[model samples]
Target chain A: MTNENAITVKNLTKTFGDFTAVDAISFEVGKGEVFGFLGANGAGKTTAMKMLIGISKPTKGEANVAGFDVRTQAEDIKKSIGYMSQRFSLYNDLTIKENIVFFGGIYGLKKSVIKAKSKNLIDELGLHDEADKLVGSLPLGWKQKVSFSVALLHDPKIIFLDEPTGGVDPITRRQFWEMIYREANNGKTIFVTTHYMDEAEYCDRVSIMVAGKIEALDTPKNLKEKYKVDSMNKVFLKLARNIE
Target chain B: MSISIKNISKSYGKVKALTDISFDIKQGELFGLIGPDGAGKTTLFRILTTLLFPDKGEATVADYDIIKDYKDIRSHAGYMPGRFSLYQDLTVAENLTFFATIFGTTIEENYDLIKDIYMQIEPFKNRRAGKLSGGMKQKLALSCALIHKPKVLFLDEPTTGVDPVSRKEFWEMLKRLQKKDITILVSTPYMDEAELCDRIALITDGEILQVDTPQAIMQAFPKTIYKVRTSETYRLIKDLKTYPKTHSAYPFGEYLHFTSTDENLDPEELIHFLEQKKHTQIEVEKIDASIEDTFMELTHTREVNAHD
Candidate 1:
């Protein structure tokens, strides 16, 4: 049955040699949902995300993202999803417009479509003044916004952001989240991982991973209430401590 | 020991790393250097700790010039770099001992200062420094930094990669260390952490943006702020920004922190405007400005003023 859920996993597990990076986790993300995947450093959030994006194979269990089986339809899954990593993945030496065109070319978009979309994105993000500037010359916040817009160049069904706002200022982070919310409103699912607990509150639902396991998964309000905490930061602390 | 920085400036080729930055850190004060990455926080820390010399300006630690008294400065201060620089292959105990020996002091002499932080990770003292968890590694690094009982401690983003709980625990440790009357200078990117500092200097792009107590900074916010939560938060932000009376509308927590160009704009009028814009379940009330809000306002104001 094709439900509203964009992603579905059952007993998903990922192991590297003897180490189980993601241990039998299961979750579902609704269409157009902003799902926050949160955990401390070295937790299984990235591993699970890699499995969902079909980059890493799951040792056991079944998983489907964007309605395709992760193992058998890995290529199809890749085409249907966009990913922005914590590390800036764009070429630093290239100009802003050049980078977007290059990514569009890789995705096999028509030159006209690339041009039109690039203009729209540049206008939307107010990057017109810096369009010809080298990506390396731009500030961290602008580069991140460009990276995110580049990720969505192909109009994928879902976007996976791994710690997208790692080092940006609060104002920039707010602006970034605004862009994410805009994408979600356009019926694109956003699955993101973040170390910033405050950012997790912006998600429709969030999953807290600890020790390769999903310790908590729910709306921010529900999780906060369940943990008897005032903020998502406090809730995460309680859960992380308990896991340890 | 007190710290004084005068007209400090550094550049890498054409890019100015720090620009005429000047600040004085009182003795035994838990002074915080708050800024984003590439804000010259690390450069300032390195210059203070005598690792790097500034092309311009002078600094003194405990009454000794940073350049002429490099040895004394190095011996009198402990520095925990942003990145874990301890020997990865060495065990926690070995690393601690190594740092202690480098300073010509044994752990026994400074054991009382680091007893609290060191005790937490003592059980895993045999584990390699690289093998420890982020929190554990932080504690071990901190303990090693304190192993020599330096007069002043310099920690550069010590809680960057650690968890929230660990960050809180680390701050508590600093508080305890403060009681011993050892001056501490910590730099952090997290705005929330600034409130924990006795006094904070907000740095950006190698410029000292503002330096004050957290409360003083918050009080200096030049606008009347309100928290607005609505069912249509995304649209509400857009709509509020378009409002003629609105000065700024930014997201904070679950609500949007908004300020108006007109101070006389009342809550009822805001609710009416939002309702007119089809926003449901609207909640609007005047609220206290936070350090993040204050910093954003200051920085944005600076940008605007510069443009003018």
Candidate 2:
């Protein structure tokens, strides 16, 4: 295992009865690299991500995340990585400050550390005025931003974001990418999945999953040249049109 | 007009869902309401479809008053809510039949209307709606919505979380349906999809920002956009935002789309500024604004005006 690699997977596979969700996929992400994982709906990207995050065990193969064995040290891997998804990330009913405190505690941070971190997080987000307000009252963009900050409260080595900008406006979406870039610049490995093809171009490297296999994996520039396309959207359309 | 909304306002308790929303959709025109979540799209749709009444203002669907001719509007409008509202327990065929029957029509009566969309899901006709994949479920929902051959179709973010490929296919379907003389009013959070509509209304925070053809909106962009590229995107964006003349700087794909507050901004001066910052592999060129650029500018200016 290379010390510079944050995540390593080798011929990982997961099956349900007769259905093969993720088929013998192999990939490696280096530390501090922004990796974009993309696929069509039901293309096994979620299954592959679940295995990498140490929640769902692979039916066959070996994988490592954050210097821990995925199968054996699943609990440790969970503790070492941060995850935020569009569907479930924060408690809407809880105030912003309370949600931060609760997530900080869940990450096993000391009370004093949590208090200091929450203050910094609120100030950084310019949400000091809305700290005591329920998270549900905040706009969708603000909620997504706050949830992302909460995910980083523990300062995990690698963070996984699932469709973080699914329905965000163009400006907020770019702001979210800026946040991702800042985290990457600070030496944090970012694993992200998004349906936005333009966003796929923002990643250091991207892998496109088809059915249950990775059909293409390369930098956006290389992928564009290889596919003879001008933009990532065309590359995606050409790749996805193959099945139909 | 196929649908018309005048000063439509709706509020839930203290939160104004839709404020002074007004738009008109011509017969057989494919119109889009483009906005993010919580932008009052669904509330406006509900009012237009006669399912809910607006606190103030008047609307008509298929030339029938929304309030007085509610039953007529209900019959003339086909609504596909954002969330799949089909019966999960029923099979694909049964769900279509149920919708057809409720409209006092039969599948055979409107078979031609949904043939293109229905055929795609016919193979899974016996499968339960709950067991269908995301794409399949969308197709089924769309088919059910069209069972009664509505005059005006209201699709509320039908492709919200759908993949790019499926989203493309869905838009193609709408285009074909539009050719059948049905007025379509669809809403989507994706700015890119706005181009597919004959006309679009950019709505945000319960207010309509702009309404025009996608091309016109881009052409009307008030600032000269510059595509700035360099080795360090993050640093370039940070520096560009801090520049005194910076109007708006947002990351677009691999490069940053920057606009200067000074009209007739010189690219050479910007290049020289970056050169002074010790940046390499720099490229700066004037580029046309896109729909997204226009949308961001409108919302940004709106925020600034609100603060003032």
Which candidate ranks first by DockQ, i.e. highest?
2
Stretches > 4 Å off in candidate 1: A1-3, A16-19
- Candidate 2: list runs displaced more than 4 Å: A1-3
lDDT assessment of candidate 1: 0.89
lDDT of 2 at A61: 92
True contacts kept of each: 0.55, 0.88
Docking class of 1: medium
Per-residue lDDT over B1-308 for candidate 1, one digit per residue giving the tens place of the 0 to 100 score = 39999999999888899999998999999999988777789999999999898999999998889999999988888899998888999999999999999888999998999899899999999999999988888888888888878899999999885668778888999999999999999999889999999999998888988999999998988889998999977898789878988888998778899988888888799899888888888998888899889878877887889999
DockQ of each: 0.62, 0.88
The lDDT for every candidate, in the order shown, is 0.89, 0.93
Q: What is the iRMSD of the candidate numbered 2?
A: 0.8
**Which has the greatest TM-score?**
2
Record all residue pairs in model 2 with backbone atoms less than 3 Å apart, i.e. clashing.
none
